[model samples]
Target: MTTVDATAIVVTHNSVSQVQDCLSALLSAGLPVRLIDNASTDGTPALVGARFPAVDLLVNDENVGFARAVNQGLAGVRTGSVLLVNPDCVLPPATARGLVEALRDRPEVGVVAPRLIARDGRVAVSAHPFESLTSVLGCQFGAALLPVPVRKLFSGRSRRRAYDACLRPGEPRTVDWVSGACLAVRTDLLLDLGGLDEGYFMYYEDEELCLRAWRRNAAVLYLPTVSATHVGGASSSPGQTWPHLYASRLRFFARHRPSTFGPVRLAVLLRALLGTALALARGLLRPGPAARRRVRAWREIYRIAAAADRTTLSQPVPMTSRSPSCT
Candidate 1:
């Protein structure tokens, strides 16, 4: 097999120092890196140019969202595999090599993700099942009722499974999907799947890509043996906290199930409405702050999901199956 020539793409804005630090880790990992600056006033371009002269840089005038910026950076990448890293995620020196090895050894794999450890050494959801409207509901709204372990079990995932397997050391193990942060994807496969769907500005774009890969009969691989620390939401703005993710969920809904806006979309809308009503009634009777907050948050999620249905009414979706309500 040929050795993979990976290109590391890092997107940056005002946090030039953080980006530089992140790039240091990637460089140490021994990969040719590309830096894409999305219209930052923080002198990130100047700092990166001066400090890492050999790095390829793209400077945009405005913050053109993560999907598009990374897509632009991807256009210049044509050789081997492509590893996309969030500027805030500091990868270990061994990470790049391990990820590349996993992808190289696993011919069936389309994307590979390393286990994500928090700075404090806790595993912070390294991977997730392919998200559907029901999967999102079960995890988001049902978290109180279904704890992490139970949730993973219901979702058909191995929580405590070892990352290394002697039998399938170089083989691809099927996973719901791999995460976007510090993910290594086969460059050609990514291109064939059309890379990141620009429709999704941030959230769920990686999942969308993996789903496309799934449709094309490619496997999403997760290697616990290879690890990286994803300081969660590192590049996102403060306003992007809960609200941004809630809004972005709609983008995901639209991309995966484009037929929602038609008669099928109305069915989803009605389901969401009925579910929200039941949640509100339960909360009102219970009279607790937690229940009330949960009800409100769930309302917002479904509202956005319904809205996304409206936005993509004209597009035609390929296929779908039965989905559960979020409430």
Candidate 2:
């Protein structure tokens, strides 16, 4: 067996229920772990200290968002590689070792992500080509809402093919980016890239990181042979994170693709408007708690998208100024 020289870094935010399992799996794999709790009010830090005493626990006074928290964890990493696994993800020792081995074998690959299996036992689509204007608009328009055939027609066959390739079990394939739910990356490469972009509060940080890695000539590899179970949306609910999702998407486009920023912004605004109208109709027609929640979420998304270039809801401090307090 290949000995894995990697420290697992899990950023937790009220992930009390999932962190136990997540840490257990990493420790069982004999990997040193560093967990950064983003001011989780549900006693997540206490639980980790009590249950997994060996884990280096870093507690934040406020929720610093995913990218920043991960950067905080990266600051103290002494390992050759770092595993950025979400608290909701559980991976076997072999899978973790395989990720490290992939990096060991391929000097050109900076990031390697395992195939993510959803809680329902379905292979999740974790890899994707870098976002273009059409892809961005397709996602903004909610391609998943349509049937598979119609979705291909609406979102383009390339998107469907990309998803299909990611879901299909095969050899390691090069991709634009992989989900951050579980990924292993070289420590030196990550630090050289200046860590994850702190501008992203929650979403799109993984994409931005991969984009930077590619810019630095480091290939992002997707390994289907290695798989992990990802309990998606453990820290926050979809309704609660919709605004952040759209805001991060706009921020990503504005920074990377300046020419398409205007179109992407317009698409986001239209999508938000459409969602708000639909949610309002649903709330009026149904008159239930769920419907009301949908209306509120959609309104928040619209508010964020309408803010022009300042789409991010909160201002993030520079990564250099922040450091994790390890215990």
The sequence of per-residue lDDT tens digits that candidate 1 reaches over residues 99-183 is 7877788788878877777778777665656555555554445543765556545553342232222112444356767678778
Model 2 error, position 162 (Å): 2.6
Quote model 2's TM-score.
0.92
Error of 2 at 15 (Å): 1.1
Q: Give the TM-score of candidate 1.
A: 0.74
Query: Which lDDT values do the candidates have, in the order given?
Result: 0.67, 0.85
lDDT of 1 at 155: 51
lDDT of 1 at 266: 46
Question: Can you write out model 2's per-residue Cα lDDT over 197-232, one digit (the tens) per residue?
Answer: 888889999998899899999999999998999999
TM-score of each: 0.74, 0.92
Residue 302 in candidate 1, Cα distance off native in Å: 9.0
Candidate 2 clash pair list: none
The local lDDT score (0 to 100) that residue 200 gets in candidate 2 is: 83
